[model samples]
Target: MSDESEALFDKADTLDEIRDKANKNSNLEMKLRNCIKDSMSKVDSLLTRNDTTQAQLTRHNELVSFMKTYCHERAYSFQIKKCQDVSCNICTPIRLPQTVFDSLHFLPDPVPALDNPDHYTSFQAVYGKQTSEEFRPSLQLNQANAEPAPKSVFASGKIRDYIMCCDCGKWHYVYSDKALSQDEIQDFKQSLYTYDYSCGAPLFPDNHYLAELLFVCVKISCDTPMEILYYSSQKSENSDICYHCGTDSDFIDPPVKMVIGPKRPRFCGPTP
Candidate 1:
């Protein structure tokens, strides 16, 4: 062959080699891109699983803490003493004290005055402020001015009373005067056991005396029979009364007082 023809053949071979290299480079780049995408997808999935696990761990920790604080064996039985005064008629219909009645004014009325005329009129006369638009009856006014009202039928001389757990010595308030039915007692117990720690304790108004009553009812119903006591006079040593939990009071330590922000800690117990 001529020299020029040989050079042309060599050039063709070089061109073919260059094309093969280019194709190989393109395939390598594509493989690298796919590998990076797979790695990133795995990383994202791992992150999601880690976050879920962390959330589960936090919830478990909260439940464990709550269980440590509240769960314990039944060491005491609750005792409620009804007023046995022959002349005192406070327990007939369970009338609320003046302070409790006044506190009700701040709450949203479930039944508006227009909806229930009789209830509204009676409530207004007793609790509502006297104004030109709303005039209270003369009889109620006379009764209000006549004399200071007597103490409540409650042993604490209030609409509600506090009783200490005989086992833990933690004070819990009782709001309801009437006894709970069997179904109600079981429901209360279920609620107490299944309470979610994630939501924290249920919030109640400062005057919500019934907040801790369910705890008392559950203890009385499930663990032991309630011990009924009687008080003839308000001066009786009722404040010192506690549930008859089998544990000795002398060995029980007082619960650590829990305080909320910018508010005085309650002596009875935590808000719940």
Candidate 2:
């Protein structure tokens, strides 16, 4: 009823109004949060459905096994033709001409004659004509000097076989009759386990034949079937064409031959 009492009642009314407004704002904020959460859940469900359809499409577009095999065969053939350098470990061993051996400053001491004539004949046959020709003079000289020949040099009678490695592109000379050394066997096994699919150019220079040969050796040694599988998905772009020869499933069209005719003179402007 008094002026101070009325002022206190008005202040209490203002505080109640403020509290009601604050409660309303809190309710609105909670509704907004729930709305955002529901919307996110719907978006995630849609994305998952879309991903499943896309995965199916991708599987449908993938290359089949036969196509993959065809591409690999073409690529392998092209690589072999391109990598015919003499330095290749898979290439046939080059026998230096007699002149080269003669020119060397430090040639192996001339092979002495064998006590058995049959052994000497067999050795000569194994060496081939050029080798026999190269050493014939030295052998005659040694015979004249009456030097006794050692039989141990050709006692084994086993020719050394060259083992070509695909991974390192190196040749290892080993006797055919003897088993591979522990280190050599371990090295082969290591290579088998750690074979690289991307080996090409520079050191290898497009040599895949040796790698195939090495894989064949692996199959024989382990008594397991091994194969190189090429997948189109591995490429940055999905393509069925051969990387080396630019060939595809379509047959190559023959080049068009153009016949050139004489050029006509330019016409002058009419009547200047």
Candidate 3:
């Protein structure tokens, strides 16, 4: 009887192993399918709009900015444990694109607004106080004992409510369930195509809320992706962190106007 019981237990363990493997394979397959489908949809939409002109490109650029915020969030799966068990061969080391990682780290570190024990303070939170004040806002300061905040806005595995427009200062609601709906995103692109994009508008500075963030004075009559030369240094190939802003990219050049966050704080010190 003991021999029979032992044999049955061994069989049960093997069956459990098979079930676990099946479940894992299903999960990976689902993630890959979603990613590929999303990419294909984007390509198809662009193809249909192949007659896109420069003005249309500007409009699409706006959509791209909005899409980028939403799309970039999908890069890592919140549902998956990035680190797996020690026995798992793929669990040894985690590597991400160094440039991307550096940019991700820039917003929350040494930004002056983010280093506080509470992690952030807006100008409203500071009100009648000096910038040098300890940014402790609440009358009770409950965050002192509150649980640490989640890293990403969409930690609940869903997109957030609305995206703020960089231009026109409007909010666009997004629906994540369907793929590539010709919603306000497409409309936004069309608006740019017809827009004269006249100059002399209040342009948002390249770097915002930096202690030394400054505006670029350009008199160009046309709308081009404005570059902000805050500082200069020749970096080696591997490092993508720009010395001033703590991030670098060929993408998302400055004067790319933004609506939300502490934008283009005026320098009371030296002019840039």
TM-score of each: 0.18, 0.12, 0.15
Best candidate, lDDT-wise? 1
Clashes in each model (backbone N, CA, C under 3 Å)?
4, 0, 0
TM-score result, candidate 2: 0.12
Q: Name the best candidate (by TM-score).
A: 1
Over 211-268, each residue of candidate 2 has an lDDT whose tens digit, in order, gives 3212211211112111111121122332333222223444332222211112111112
Candidate order, TM-score descending: 1, 3, 2
* TM-score, predicted candidate 3 vs. hidden true structure: 0.15
Local distance difference test scores for all models: 0.37, 0.33, 0.34
lDDT by residue (tens digit), candidate 1, 1-272: 34643443445466566455436667544554554466434323232224455466445553344334423322132222224345533223336774664454321122326657665544445443422323235545665444222223233223233344434443344434456667655655554454422111231323443343332322232144222321222433344322333232343322345221222122222222
- Model 1 TM-score, all chains together: 0.18
Whole-structure CA lDDT of model 1: 0.37
Q: Give residue 34's error in model 2 in angstroms.
A: 99
CA shift of 197, model 2, Å: 7.3
Q: What lDDT does candidate 3 reach at residue 64?
A: 56
* Pairs that clash in candidate 3: none
Model 2 weakest lDDT span, ten residues long: 224-233
